[model samples]
Target chain A: MTGQSTVLAADVPFPPSVEDFYLPSIVPWGGHDSYWFTKITALLWISVALIIIFFLVTYRKPKLVPTKKQWIAESIYGFVRNNIAVDMLGKRGINFAPYLTTLFVFILIMNFWAIVPFAQISPNSHIAFPAVLAVISYVMFIYIGMKHHGGLKYFKHALIPPAPWFILPLLIPIEFFSTFIVRPFSLAVRLFANMFAGHMLLLVFTLGGFAMLNANVWFAPFSVVSWAMTIALTFLEFLVICLQAYVFTVLTASYVQGALADEH
Target chain B: MGMTAVAYLIAGMLVWGGIGLLVDHWVGTKGIFAGIGAVVGIGGGVYLIVRRLGA
Candidate 1:
């Protein structure tokens, strides 16, 4: 038991760090110097390819009597359209349904990788991916507002609320901070933080199990418990993946709805 | 809707408290302005929420 525990201890690195998020470079064959490509990149590309191919193949020929594949594809689109877009934006929701559906699907797949075998890290755990998505949503809502309200009047409408003249100064800055600054920052940070935390939790539990097993014979029971917790947390991670994806899509739709609303 | 309300509350505090901190720096006050700023900011946040999110 002593000898086996020692070997196991050496195999498992206890207490994961930020460095674990940075996987070894795949291109140039595991070279440390270059991160030209990594598992994260592969997961992202695979997600994109899978989504595109799935939609294209499923919808290549429109059928009045939908097949299973078509039903699944249509269900995904219809769910976003009816549940998120239309619910949030009303009549104009159909116009934005495609983009919102794409966003929801992409985020769901990217986050799902955290619980997936082999590819155990989600690209969204990295802030860069979520930040980019947030920027797109930010720019979109502003653009829609400007177009709907006509020119700089959009800023006027968004910033100047239906309040009296005396309190305008205080309210304006608050509105600016909340609307302009907070919206995108929160959007990106929310998604990035959720995925990042989810991955870190799984790593801690999984590695902690091995660490315990390596520590001593008596700790073997605790090791099994830790592994069980890891399995349970994976199921929990699946829930977060779906939720964050839905929340991101819904918030984006809500922002667009905010932008498109007429003056009261 | 929940997130938006949170953002508004946080934004109000941040915007006002930040302004207060700057005022404290300029006036050489001992955190009084900062405290005042936060309260005022939060008050404005509640008002904004009522106007924007209230039915």
Candidate 2:
């Protein structure tokens, strides 16, 4: 009674707060201040844990006749083996199928987190994640190249391609720059920047709706339109998510193939 | 971005690239070109940073 207002308040305004909108981290670890970090990291780890658990459980008891889970696992394995490895790297590439498949599925799951509710962030949107992945692929390919060809031969193959001598100066430097520097950087940055910008755009529209809702009674109706756009964008993000993952895996296979081949 | 931030970013990228090159070499791949590329990236990064900061 003592704390009662002098006049009864009917329309209590919701104070503008920072909590409602999501702002992506521009640098790695920048999001630790917000829910974005916890949500995205937890979801990513959970995806990894689930993949491991699924494979372990499904393959723990192998059989000549497959169970439902076994069939699903085999299908996924075969899909990458046949489609990505064999198609890109040829028959010898079958051996790389498992690693490439793991990379694809893991990245796909991380990318999918962008569209998932509550989490609403892609881990790969952070440059560090993609950079780490690119490094792994870079290392793998280099290892494969050396393992296949001898020490000096790999360098000779990578730089000195089967081309005319006149173009050697231009091509060698260009090839060298592209294969070593541009390839991995572009691989990482492309995925990170795309996902990051996509998520940021989604955030802007979605939060704009909420911000508008607080403006006036007339503004309330426009929120639905904003939401509709958000939904459409969400669908587009899904396509991008899958496409980026595929591109990453495909590029990895191609790099490995290039490394293994006699010709550059 | 601030000059320091730009500098740090360039340095980080170069260091990472160098690390990548060294790893490739250690793994037994002929990574001489890769190492050169890393050095070039570092130089490019420094040049870009210098130009931006100078402006």
Candidate 3:
């Protein structure tokens, strides 16, 4: 430790460090504790409210001709409904469009918050949000499986699969652990890791660019190049934001489909 | 999606292997149970992934 000489870093503007990619808190309290109105928390609430407002404004009055706002809303709904739900679940998916659509849009908006001006960090970059979403999906599929297949039968179908009875014992634990435990855990980890990585990449290029600006006169031009990379990555983040949302929604639909199906 | 499969596979091994270690402690055995648990976990994980995700 450079002791007294060491500087206050990243989250501060004066000197940039890689740690700037994380450890910023708009709220004074611990996130795991009560009274945590951190930046991520606010963004999560705002994302939900904005999405509600978006839909309300667009479809407040149904129009035959359709205004531009209505068209945008319809397209978003149709895209998720047709492309994700219907495509994965077939005709059986028609009833699920609303649920899947809302899930898709919510995840998209929360993730896209990372690139927004004042809200440069995504809430899903944190593990808790993803975990909650994943758990909801897990419980949903489990409920569907149980309801459709019957209580004991659902466990039988899930644990035994279509395999022969001789090997059922070995497969039971594997299936139980993977389906019950791993599904939600992996779902959460996947979303959290992607958002976390994307944010880090942006922080790296943007802050590195600014820091390089004063590294030396000769290195100053490279700072511009770094800033350019940051801009490029921002656009990439847009694709990632949409893609992750779509992927999550599709997987959830697929899980539902699997539960309803006669066989795996 | 591919990464999820990988995570599942790795998670299975770690999770089951931990269980095996606990069992080993309870039974006062060596690493035998843990090794078997790990291999079984890996095999089961790969089998499930391929069945679910393979085209």
Candidate 4:
């Protein structure tokens, strides 16, 4: 098994690092100086364009009889609208259905890139994308809370739970830290870390094959097993991709619900 | 709800443990304040969880 391909496998960079995530510049055509455009940027724009074009094309004609494309579009929208938004937020969910649907679709597509043939890396593996998404959720919930509760009353509602006066100091700090600090941080890190770890796992298995094959001719069968494990992990990665997207959307909706709730 | 509970627990430890460290630095004690802060923080965490999530 470790035949002529051993020469080609010699360059397989074992133990992939964080540096592997920093892809080269696309605009400058592999130049290191300007990273204004890269695979991550391209994937992001592609996801945006694909979503826009898909929805526009599917909904171009309002058919009572529902074509295949329209059904798909409707199903995607309906899934997020009914299941996530409405289920979490009740009648008020309709107001947020559009934003939540868009968020769900965008994150789903971005995460799907991890298992894609040519595009093996997801843009979400980088913290920037998820961080921005988390910030939006954080700001949106706070804004909604403030609007609903009439000013600083939202802070009182969120931070000052239904508790007595004496132990208020202890509980208050925990609530503040959990709500104000932990929510956004965990939201961003959860998605980023999942994608990052998934990619790293695939890299390790894939490159480990080459490393094993190069170690000894007797290890060729082990290299094949390693490659097999990579294939298995790809399926697991798919499950994670859908799960993370759903989790992100659901959590956002839940946070919105928490904000909009009237005093427990 | 699960995430919220976890956040509460972690936040309790971090907030109190961080305060404990500050106290330790101030009082020139070793890890005593830090340990006490951690214990107090976790206790607060459990109380918060019961009050907020036990329903």
Candidate 5:
């Protein structure tokens, strides 16, 4: 929140800087050292709570004709169910609709938090959170393949593509890393980098604009331009946030599809 | 083979190449081991992609 970072007195040689924007405190309240209760942790829980509350309110009672709440809920569910899971996995994907929907919405909210006023940072900007999400997707992708095919068959299918035995030494490690390790690593990095970069961009403009305003009368116009850029970037960030969420959901579904397929 | 396969290839080379560099550091053999690891990684990655996706 720029509250602590805004203090910049000329008396002190070390004034507020941009790195201060990312509140990397181990503990929120001054207490024991802990990873718990960080801003990102709160954001993650808020996202989960919002999703649960959304569905809970929407489907509390059975209705022949749906209300606005039901309509919104159904639309979200339908989009993931039909557009993502169904499209990727066909009839077999029906069982995965709920999981995909949860994933899409969770990511959407986490990303959306960056642009939200007062809550300017996104939890996904941190690697740890994205890493966990990626691990979940990675495990599921591998697990589905393993379940569909036997364990031995699944690894064979994943590791050994239709290639000559002579190339095995070259192919095996690449396949192992790319197919198994890369999936989760890339997923986490992609999300973390986007969110991290977005937050930094916003911080620069917002803080630069403020710094300019406080510095001199001649710099006021440039301050206005900085603020304008910040506003414009907010809209672009909104689109990106939604898009990233959709991309994550779609890729997850496709991974499942790949896993379930008879062969690559 | 696919974007995913390509990603795998890059990841493979990066990871193995990194390990090779680490080993080189341990052995103090300059970039020799890293070069070997990188070449093997490229071949393996390409082979993996080709086998699964073909061509």
Candidate 6:
């Protein structure tokens, strides 16, 4: 068994870092310089395109009675509407259903890319992507808040937090800092950091298995355990992908609600 | 790796918080905008570390 284990480890190939992961560019713009940006951007667009095409194909003809694709589309829409928006934002949430649905589905697809065989990297794992999404949410909430309430009142509501005047000295500044500044930043970092760490962990176990295999006969059997853990973790990552996407969308709706609320 | 991760998380929170404060000040509204900014900052900071290190 030990002899076979060592041989098995030597035969396996471990996955590498994102920097080392080679994805063929859809259209090769340049070789070395454009490697990260061109390919990654193209893949990102592909994901976006797939999403659009999916919806378009599924809902080309709307009907009271649905087809499989339409059902998928409807189910996805319903999930976001009922589970996230309504649950988090209440009756007012119905208005935000479309935006929340888009956020959830878009993020879910991007995250699912990590588990896909050929496309193993998650777009959200890239800080820039999450940062952009965070900015979008920030703008959406702030704009809605200001648009609904006068800017002066909105700012007052955000900072004041319905507290006493004496406490105002300390509370006001802190409220401003948390509500305006920290919300969006955490919004982006939460998604980015989770995906990044998940990908890195998967990489570590995968590579460790391979490295151990070659180290000695005794190390070979451990590769089986490593591989087993990796498989289990992959399933957990799937849950995370969905959970994170939901969390992001729900939080976005919450922020929007916060902005639109008459009082803090 | 751990230190780098911590630094990135902290930096992200501070940058966002600072931006929030600047935005509030620029808009010329008086209230505890700074307080909101700090809450958002600390929330983001803790969220980053938890998301990364937690399962």
Candidate closest to the true structure, highest TM-score: 1
Q: In candidate 2, which residue ranges exceed 4 Å CA deviation?
A: A1-37, A216-218, B1-55
What are the TM values for chain B, all candidates? 0.97, 0.48, 0.86, 0.96, 0.82, 0.58
RMSD to true structure for each model, in Å: 1.1, 12.5, 4.9, 1.3, 4.3, 9.2
Q: Report the poorest 10 consecutive residues by lDDT, candidate 6 chain A.
A: A20-29
Docking class of 1: high
Cα lDDT tens digits, model 4, A56-168, are: 99999969999999999999999999999999899999999999999999999999999999999999999999999999999999999999999999999998877789988
Top lDDT: which candidate number? 1
**Candidate number with the higher DockQ (4 or 6):** 4
Model 5 superposed RMSD (Cα): 4.3
lDDT of 5 by residue, A112-216 (tens): 999999888898887887889899999999999999998879998877767678866666666677778778887888888888888888877877777775666
Clashes of 3: 0
Task: List candidate 4 segments past 4 Å from native.
Answer: A1-3
lDDT of 2 by residue, B1-55 (tens): 3423343345535554666687777877787656665666555445434433344
What TM-score does each of the candidates earn?
Answer: 0.98, 0.70, 0.81, 0.97, 0.83, 0.76
Model 1: CA > 4 A from native: A2-5
Q: Residue-wise lDDT of candidate 3 within A51-170, one digit each (tens)?
A: 999999999997999999999999999998888888878897888899999999999999998899978989898888999999999999989889999887887777665556775555
User: What is the lDDT, from 0 to 100, of the residue A231 in candidate 6?
Assistant: 90
Task: State the weakest 10-residue window (summed lDDT) of model 5 chain A.
Answer: A5-14
In candidate 2, position A24 carries an lDDT of: 53
Residue A125 of candidate 2: its Cα lDDT? 79
lDDT of 6 by residue, A1-264 (tens): 467755765665655666644555444554655455555576688889999999999989988999888998999999889988888678988999998898888899898888888677788888888999999999999889888888777787665645456645544544555567777888899999888878888887887887777776787689788878889989989989988998888788878877877641
Candidate 1 vs candidate 6: the lDDT winner is: 1
Instruction: Supply candidate 6's per-residue lDDT for A95.
Output: 92
Candidate with better TM-score, 4 vs 5: 4
What's the lDDT for residue A171 in model 6? Answer: 45
lDDT of each: 0.94, 0.73, 0.80, 0.93, 0.80, 0.75
